[model samples]
Target: MPELTMVQAVNHALRDEMRADDEVVVLGEDVGLNGGVFRCTADLFEEFGEDRVIDTPLSESGIIGAAIGMAMYGLRPVPEIQFSDFIWPAFDQITSELAKMRYRSAGQFTCPLVIRTPYGGGIRGGHYHSQSPEAYFTHTPGLVVVVPSDPYDAKGLLRSAIQSEDPVLFLEPKRIYRSPKMEVPDDDYTVEIGKAAVRREGTDFTITCYGAMVPVALEACKKAAEKGWEGEVLDLRTLLPLDTDALIDSVTKTGRMLVLQEAPKFCGYGSELCAIVAEKAIDVLEAPIKRVAGFDVPFPYTLEHVYMPHADRVLRGIEEMMDY
Candidate 1:
């Protein structure tokens, strides 16, 4: 086992996929030689050659649009958006063309591509580079959204995302790219997407989160345990086909839930989880389902700490729910 950062883990996945499948290709800004702005693709071009690891022009729309054509021709194209903030320009290609191509073709065509981008705050990227856009793609049918918390999940889920039959929007937490480190398995293993993991299990209360927010929730739980509160923390590794059963079960067991996230509160993934908890496990709740999320305003220039959901905020939600 080797302790790898989020960036290194993702790099491993892409390298493994490209080696395993000749049809696999990666295209994005500086992906060929510079290894991406974050170096997630560092050295991929040198190994796989320029034809496979392409350095595309600075055009998100063109990258995604061209990827769709490649997939239609039976190639698995992985396109990278330097930042989630820049993906809006290619939103049409994703939501309209790539997403519908598979269904519209009715078994005639499949656009099995992965749009990988880094998201979330804690890097002082202000509004643009710090945003979490998973909710946007999750809203659009036919697109799968994945947000992995740690190094292990990063490598595994990216492998699964690349091989997934549907077009996947893979969001890596930029903040955790270099911060958190964990032992990744030596051999190849892809974590099945759309499954939520119970990071810390307890019956007191459940705090559910994904991506970098998982660490916050776990830290809050650790603190709560010292004060005699055993909090259950669930990491929703895959945001799209959410493991609603695990969520409902955890909430039902604890009879309390506080959905924590880095994304803004308005119509975010937390909203969907909250609604699901209400609909499926309302009778099991001891109190109203609570949320600890970023403020609905744009990410601040200097108040990044205040804007993001922190350990205190998560603990506060726990206190509120347990008190109620």
Candidate 2:
């Protein structure tokens, strides 16, 4: 076992997959020589050389279009989109072409590809750079959307994504890229997609979240413990194909639920979680499902602290749910 950050774990997964399978290729801007903008692909170019690691022009649509072609031809391509905020430029290619490959072809063709992109706010990235557009893709059919909150899951989920036959959107939370180092196994392992992990267990309430908000929820649970409110933190690592069983179980046990996300609250991912609980576990609910999320506004550059959900804000939401 070795201690690694999320970024290092991502690089390790890419290296391991590329070594195990020659078909696994990495292509994106600065991913070859520059080691990627976040260094997630550091040193891969020197080892694999040009054919396996390619640097492309600054075009999201072109990058994705080429990767789709490679995938359809039997090569497992992992294309980097730099940031989730820039993914819209290639939305048509992803949602229309990439997503519809298997269905449109009636099982005759499948696109085995992973689109890697850093997402969410926490590094002062303004409106252009800091946006959580996960809801858009999660709503789409035939695509797997994954978000890892720690290095351990980051390595495993990425490996699983590369091995998946279906196209995957791997969203890496840029905030915890380097922090929260953990001991990750050097051997091959994988965290199954579409499963949620219970980061903390409690009996009073459940705090459901994913990606960067997982840590924030955990912190709020810690603070709530001091106030005699035992909180459970459920990390929904995979947004699409959500682990509905785990979600319903947690809410049923605690009898209260709080959904959190860095995205805007208006029609955000949290809304779906709330709806799921309301639809399936309404009878067991003791109180209204509370939500603490980013404001329904553009990601601000200056007031990020206020716009984004924090531990204090989450604690308040917990208190309200508990009191109700």
Candidate 3:
């Protein structure tokens, strides 16, 4: 095993997948020649050639539409939407067509594709590049939303997503893309989707989060520990088809819950998580569930730190839950 950054792990996964399956093709703006905006697909153009590693026009809808067509024709297409904020142009293709192909065709057709996009605040990408839009896709009926926190899971989950016989929305947090290297296996492996990983074990309370917010939640737990409260940290790597069983188990033991997210609070993913706990495991909770999330307003340029949920906000939410 070797330590690799999230971006490096992503590149490794693409290379490995391309080698293993001829059906796997990479397509998106600057993904081929330019190696993607973040270099997640670097050197792939030379290795796989122009036919396999395609560089598409500057149309998000066209990119997704072409990918959907390719998938229908039995090719595994991994299309990268340069930024999650710019993905709206292809929303109809994703929600209406890509997500509904299997159900609409009564299992006669399946969209074996992955839409990779950089998401979340931090790194000062402002509103145009840093929006967290996983909730919208997660609400769709047939889509699988996955957000990996570290490099290890980033590679494994991506491999799993590409291999699955369904459309997967793979949201990569741009904040820590090049930071925090983690040991990842060089062999073939896949992280099971729809499973929540308990990063840290504790009994005082449980902090559930995913993507960039996972690190913030862990930091909040560390802060809590310093104040004599050991908070368990649960990373919902797979957002849609959430691992509620894992969530309930941890909340049941901790008797308190704090859900965190970089997305806005109103009708956000954290609210859905909190609602699930309130419905299924409310009896086991010692206090009301708390949710720490970005404000409802649009992501601001100058107030990046204020807009995104941080360790201090999560710690405050945890303390509020405990005191309640």
Candidate 4:
């Protein structure tokens, strides 16, 4: 095992997978010669050559449309959308065609496609580049939504996504791409999709979060620990087929819940988690479920800190829930 950043871990996964399987091809704008805007695909072009590591046009729709065609024919295509904000142009192709391919064909075909894109705020990208539109795709039935919080999960979950038969939207949090280095195995491994990880265990309350917010939640839990309050932090790695059992168990044990996310509060992914607890574990709740999230406004370039939730904001929510 060797220490690697999230970006390096993702690159290693891509390189390893492409070596292990010839059908695994990477296609996206600047992914080849540029090694991707974030350099997640660094050196892949030189190692695998043009056919495997392809540099695509600027059109997001074309990138995904071509990948879907490749998937239909038996090649596992991993298309990279430079940013999640730019993915809307390919939304129709993903939701209508990529997602429904298997069901529509009555099992005749499957889209083993992984659409990887950098998402969320932390780098001060304005409205055009920092949006978190995961809620839109999570609502779709056929797609799998995955967000990795650290380098370890980044590599493992990506391997699993590439191997999955269903179309996967692998959202990488750009904020912690280079930080939080961790020891990751050189050999292949897969983190099962649809499962959440309990990052911290505590008895007082449960804090549910994922992606960029995972670090915030962990930091908040640390602050609470110093105040003689224990907080359990649950990282919801896979969003679509949520780990409902783990969520309910944590809430049931702690008797209080606070959902954290970088997205807006209204109809955000946190709302779904809150609703799930309210529906299934209402009897175990000692206090009403609360959420600390981004403001219901466009992601601002200057006011990025004010718009997104921080450890203090999360700690305040925890205190309120504890006092209630």
Q: Which candidate number would show the highest lDDT if scored against the true structure? A: 2
- lDDT (Cα atoms) of all candidates against the true structure: 0.91, 0.95, 0.93, 0.94
Question: Taking the tens digit of each residue's C-alpha lDDT, what string does model 4 give over 161-219?
Answer: 99999999999999999998999999888899999999999999999999989999999
TM-score of every candidate:
0.98, 0.99, 0.99, 0.99
Clashes of each: 0, 0, 0, 0
True-structure RMSD, every candidate: 0.9, 0.7, 0.8, 0.7
State in Å the error of residue 110, model 1.
1.0
Clashing pairs in 4: none
lDDT of 2 at 310: 98
RMSD of candidate 3 to true structure, Å: 0.8
For model 2, what is the alpha-carbon lDDT of residue 315? 96
lDDT of 2 by residue, 153-265 (tens): 99999999999999999999999999989999999999999899999999999999998999899899999999999999999999988999999999999999999999999
lDDT of 3 by residue, 1-324 (tens): 799999999999999999999999999999998999999999999999999999999999999999999999999999999999999999999999999999999998889999999999998988799899998999999999999999999999999999999899999999989999999999999999999999999999998888888889888889999999999999999988889899999999999988888898899988888888889888998888888889999899998988889899888988898788
- TM-score of model 4 vs. true structure: 0.99
Error of 1 at 133 (Å): 0.8
